[model samples]
Target chain A: MYEAALTLYGEAGWAGFSLDAVARRARVGKAGLYSRWGSKERLIVDALAAWIPPRPSGGGPGPLREELIRLATAIFDSYFDPVGLVYLRAQLEAMIYPDLFGQALERLQRERIRLGRAIVLRAVERGELPEGTSPALVLDSVSGILSNHVLSTPASQRRALLGRRDEYVEQTVDFVLSAVGYRAQGRDGLLSL
Target chain B: MYEAALTLYGEAGWAGFSLDAVARRARVGKAGLYSRWGSKERLIVDALAAWIPPRPSGGGPGPLREELIRLATAIFDSYFDPVGLVYLRAQLEAMIYPDLFGQALERLQRERIRLGRAIVLRAVERGELPEGTSPALVLDSVSGILSNHVLSTPASQRRALLGRRDEYVEQTVDFVLSAVGYRAQGRDGLLSL
Candidate 1:
C-alpha cells in the first residue's frame, strides 16, 4: 500500500498526488491507509526510508578496491529508483519553501553527510584511503556530483543522461577513490594509463 | 559606482538594496547612475560583466594542471568578494524567477562550460588527459562542487568550510585530472599517498 502511494507521488509530484489516488492504486481502504501512515508527510517520509539502500554488507576481509566499487555502485543505484528521485525533488522544493521545508531538508542533508562520512571513514580504516583525508569533504564532493546528475531536468535529456550515468558514476568514484589514494582494479579501462 | 551597487545588493539581498543606498556608497549623483545603468536589474547585469575575472594570460602554453588550478582558484577567490557573492546568490534566485532574470544565467553557464571544455580539450590534445572524457561532464562536476560550496550557508559554518575549500578544490581537480587519465604526479602533495 505504501509503495503504491510512492508510485502515485512519483508520477504526480506532491500537489497532484492524493490519498484517494493512492488508495485506489493500492486497492486498499482509505481508513486503513490513514491508520498505517497518518499524513502525507508521514507517508512520504516512510517511502523515503523504504527506498534507501540497506546498509552495505561484505565488509569483513573484503578487497578494499572491490568493496569501494560495490559501495559506490549501491549508492549510485539508489538514485536510479523512482521513489529516490521523487524524494530528492521533494526535498529540493522544500529547500525553497524554507518555512515548511527547511527542517526536513536540514535533517536529510545532515543524515546524508553522516552516512557519507562513515563510508569514507571505513574506507580509510581499511587502508582503502589515505589517513588525513576529511571524510566529510569527500562525501560532499561525491554527493554533489551524483546529486547534480540526478537533479538535471527536461525529462527528454534524462535518457541520454541515464545511458551516461554509469560512466559519470565510475569516473566520479575513480576521482574520489584516487583522491583518497585508493587503487581500484578496473579504472585502467577508463583511465588509459 | 556599479561595484558599490553590486556589493549593496549582495549584503542586503534584492528587496533590501536601494538605489539611494548605492548612491550613498558610490558617492555619486543619482542622476549620473540613472543616466548610465537605468535600474537595479540593469546595474546588476553590467556589474556581472565588469566583475568577472579577466581571463588569465597562460595562452596556448603551460601545463593543463596549473591552468585548471588557476581557474578554480579564480572562482573560489571571487566568493570572498561581496559583489561576487551577491551575483552568485542573485543568479540562484533567478533560476526560479526566470521571467525576471531572463536568459542571462543560461548564457552565463554556457559560456563557463565553453571555457571549461576549451581547457579540457586542450589537455586531450596535449595527451595529458584521456581521449574519450566528456568535457561537458567534467565541467558539470566542477560547477556542482563549486556551487555546493557557495550554497552552504550559516555564515560561521561557511567560514569553517572555507578552511577546507583548498583541500576540497585540490581533490576535485585531482579527481577530474585523473579520471581523464592524466599521469599521476608522484607525491602530489595534497592527497598524501
Candidate 2:
C-alpha cells in the first residue's frame, strides 16, 4: 500500500496526488486507506518515515577514514535508490505546503544529523579528527554535496553517476576529510594525496 | 511581467501554472504573451535567464580566496532571492514532466557549469589551487553545497542562515579550498583557520 502511494505521488506531484488515486492504484477500498491513515498527509508522513533508510551505525573496528568511507557510501546508495527519489520529489511539496510537509522532513533531518554527529564524535575519541572539529559543519558538507548531485543532475547523468557510486563516495569522503583539515593519506583510484 | 510569472509559478507550481493566470497577474492579454514567447516554457526559460544573477567575474585584483568568497556569496544571494524560489519550485516539475522541464534546466546548468569552471581556472592560474585540481569537481562541490542548503533547509532556519551569509560563504570557501589541497591563511570572523 505504501509502495502504491509512493508510485502515485512520484508520478503526480502534490497537486495531482489524490487519496482516491492511491486507493485505485493499491486495489484497496477508500475505507481501507482512511481507516489505516485517516488523511492523505498522514499517509505520506508514515510512508516517508518507513521509506527512509535507518541511521547508519558507526563504522565498526576500522580506521576513521575507512569507517567514514563506509558511512558515506551507505548514504550515497540510499539516496540514489528509486524509493529515495520518490521521497525527494515529495519533499518539494514543502515549498508549497510548509506546514503539511515540513514536520516530517524536519524530523528526518534531525535524525540524520544526530547520526552524523555520533560518527564524528567516535572519530574524535579515536584521535582521528581535531578536538574542535564541528561535526554539524562536516556532516553538512558531505550530505550537501550528495544531495545536490542527486537533486540537480539530469536523469541520464544521474544514472551514470550512480554507476560510479564507489568513486563518488570516495571523492566525497576525501573532500569531507579535507574540509575538516585532515589530509587523507593514500594513492588509491582518483584520490592521490 | 516576469516577476508576475515567477510569483504565479512559485505559488501554484508547474502543474497549476497557467498562461492565463500569468496574463491576469501581469495585466496583459493572452495574445501579447503568445506573440512574445510563443509558449509558456520559452517564457519561463527567458525569465529565469534574466533573473538568475550573472556569473561573478571572479573578484578582480584580490587574493584568490577573496575572489572565491565573493563568487560564493553572490551565488548564495541569488539562490535565496524570491525569483530563485520560483525556479526551485519549477525544477521539481522535472520529476513529473521530465521532457517539458529538462530541456530548460539542462541549458541553465550547462551555463552555470561553464561560468564556474572559469572561476576555478582563474584560481589555478593564480596559484591558489593545485595544478591537477579538477575545475568541474570543484564547481560541483561549491554549487552543490549552496543548492542543498537552499532547497532542503526549512524557511525560518534558511532565513537565519541567510542572516549569516558572509560567515556561511567563508566556511564553504574554506572547505572548497581545503578540498583542492590548499589551506586558507586568514582568521577573521567565524573561520578560525
Q: State the DockQ, from 0 to 1, for candidate 1.
A: 0.10
- The numbered model that scores best in TM-score is 2
Which predicted model would earn the best DockQ? 2
After TM-score superposition, the amount by which residue B165's alpha carbon in candidate 2 deviates from its true location, in angstroms, is 2.4
Candidate 2 local lDDT, residue A74: 68
Look at candidate 1 and give me any clashing residue pairs: none
* Model 2 misplaced regions, further than 4 Å: A31-39, A49-51, A54-62, A78-82, A86-96, A150-156, A182-193, B20-24, B27-62, B86-97, B149-156, B183-193
Any runs in candidate 1 off by more than 4 Å, and if so which? A1-112, A119-134, A146-193, B35-38, B49-51, B54-60, B146-168, B184-193
Give the number of the best model, judged by lDDT.
2
What DockQ results do all the predictions give, each relative to the true complex?
Answer: 0.10, 0.34
Looking at model 1, residue A69 earns an lDDT score of 56
Clashes, model 1: 0
Candidate 2: clashing pairs of residues: none
True contacts kept of 2: 0.29
Residue B94 miss distance in model 2 (angstroms): 3.9
